[model samples]
Target: MRRVQVRKTHKLFIGGAFPRSESGRTLVVEGANVARASRKDLRDAVRIARQAGAGWSGATAYNRGQVLYRLAEMMEARRGALAAACRGKDEVDRAIDRVVWYAGWADKLAQVIGSANAVAGPYFNFTVPEPTGVVGIVAPAEPALLGLVSRLAPPLVGGNTVVVIASDAHPIAAVELAECVATADVPPGVVNILTGLRGELAPWLAGHMDVAGLDLAGADGDAAELERLGAENVKRIVRGKADEQSPYEIAAFLELKTVWHPVGF
Candidate 1:
């Protein structure tokens, strides 16, 4: 009798195809080979994100919150898989914690990040944070899970759709998180994730005309090229600060809009 061997599955998740990158590229990861997404695939993700974003952004804040919390719940349920994908206890734990933390923020962000403002010039004013539409994030390479979770949370919590490029070296955990997003009830385009080499893909997304804002937190070395690319479209660039644990990240992904009204006579 002859022994049978099973082949491993390596494909891109796009429009439900799960096909290899259109460019037919592959890269090595953890002694295993994985598909390397092409520029065309990245553009496909952007198109998906754009088509789905308006409806997602228009969805009620409560609906968005429900979806985000659901993703966190899903993440919690899949901790074991995520742990395995990330390949470490600390990585998995931090990722899980990030989901839980951001889960709470979904409903509370309006209160925590918004406030009433007193206008010295006789008008009544209040300010609140609003979603800036489709956000493109370059997921960080180090501390993969936590960085990925941190990058995704704040923007989605604020009702924005996201297109994230997962870490190149450690891509599994990021893809696993996409499962959480899909099951969490998030609209398809609301959290489109692309698994590829960030160095290759980030520039294109940063410069994409349709992207409303950019989060380069996952990028390295001042992200000078990303910044320049984003400038072409006037996309808001969220700067990476020195403090990794700062709540400022929550606000960086948001836009402050002030509404003013006359104090009636």
Candidate 2:
């Protein structure tokens, strides 16, 4: 008898662990049953992200960069698997390179994004970028791996934990990437990915008071409503490009803090 090939259960990645949706729901996509996350699951992810973000944001910038690079290494090791999951090898390559690119930015962002300012009073003042905390991301639908990676990397580099709604039609790549994150030395809850209907999950994330930043790049038709909900908590909302590679991307998920020191004679 031929050995049977067992199918892998595609589940939601939360707090560095894979678990079935609390609602025990699954949606079949491309003949594969993927976990369909529920509102309760979204709430859980946000709570975990908030707790994990403190330690992540407090870590040295250089350390964050190393972790990102390690993720890139993990992605590289899984290149063939990633290529099979979404799009093609080109996209997987781009996603890996993008992770590495953001890794490079982690240590240098302060130099490029911060500045000392001349003040009128007898004091010294300078502004530095800090993590926004518990950023919620809606991953775009096309070029699945690359687009998702593009949005995910910037926030991770900037030290903000993320709860991303992976592309609805193509979620395997997100789960695969989560596997990379799991082995990349990332702290639990630093990056959580949920595979489900964007329409259902995104609204909850948008209105979540604990979510300090919301990236609605893939919110599409629901962007207006989501933005409105996010406004209630004064979230830093951004609809960034799917293929963008800029320091601004990292800055979008960050908060600028200015410190003042007295220079009295």
Candidate 3:
């Protein structure tokens, strides 16, 4: 008798649990059948993200940093597998390092991006950065692992929950990364991964009123239409080159809040 191998069914990660697509559809990509996430899936992800946002955002920066560091550790432990999934060890190494880099910034972002303001009156004023709530990301098509990590880390470090549509052409790495997220002490719903056609999902994500921001790093097809939909909710839209990493990427998903206190009271 011959031993049989059981193939794994990759599903959408929503609210910390893996679930089949609401539409019960799958597309063959890269020799594998991946969930073809529908608009309903995107909407469900946004709802989960919104529900998780407050808890994740209200967490102490130190705690968030620790959680991110844990994710890096999980990635490091699975480096070989992740590297193989992405077809490049170097990209996996860089992705792990990127997570660590963002982890370090979690606690420092407030200091680096915010400041005390000088007012003429007897008032002490200061500005602070706050998470932009739920964010939607279109992960890049190539360099799948690195691009996804780069786009995800910053917003996560800044305390935003995300609904990410992984690269349709190269979604294996994203599915593997979702496993890491599930086991790395990350809060459920803080990061949801949907693997499907960008064309099918980007419009719905951009137009979602509850999603506060959109990262169109790997967006394809009508850019104008995406922007137009985003404008409906006044969402903060960021278009960037793939694999670009910067603190400003995190700032893009953050809103600055100012406070005023009586100085001589």
Tens-digit lDDT track of model 3 for 1-265: 9989887788889999999899999999878899999999999999999999999999999999999999999999888779877968899999999999999999899899999998899998999999999999989877889989999998999999999999989988899899899999999999999999889899999899999998998876767789899999799998866787788989999999999988763
lDDT of 2 by residue, 185-229 (tens): 999999999999999999999999999999987878899999999
**lDDT, candidate 2, at 109:** 90
lDDT of each: 0.76, 0.94, 0.91
The number of the candidate with the highest TM-score is 2
Between 1 and 3, whose TM-score is larger?
3
Measured on C-alpha atoms, candidate 2 has an lDDT of: 0.94
lDDT of 3: 0.91
Candidate 2 Cα deviation (angstroms), residue 12: 0.5
User: What's the alpha carbon RMSD for model 1?
Assistant: 2.9
What is the Å distance of residue 105 in model 2 from its true position?
Answer: 0.8
lDDT of 3 at 228: 92
TM-scores across all candidates?
0.86, 0.98, 0.97
Clashing pairs in 3: none
Choose 2 or 3, whichever is better by lDDT: 2
- Candidate 2 residue 106 Cα shift, in angstroms, is 0.9
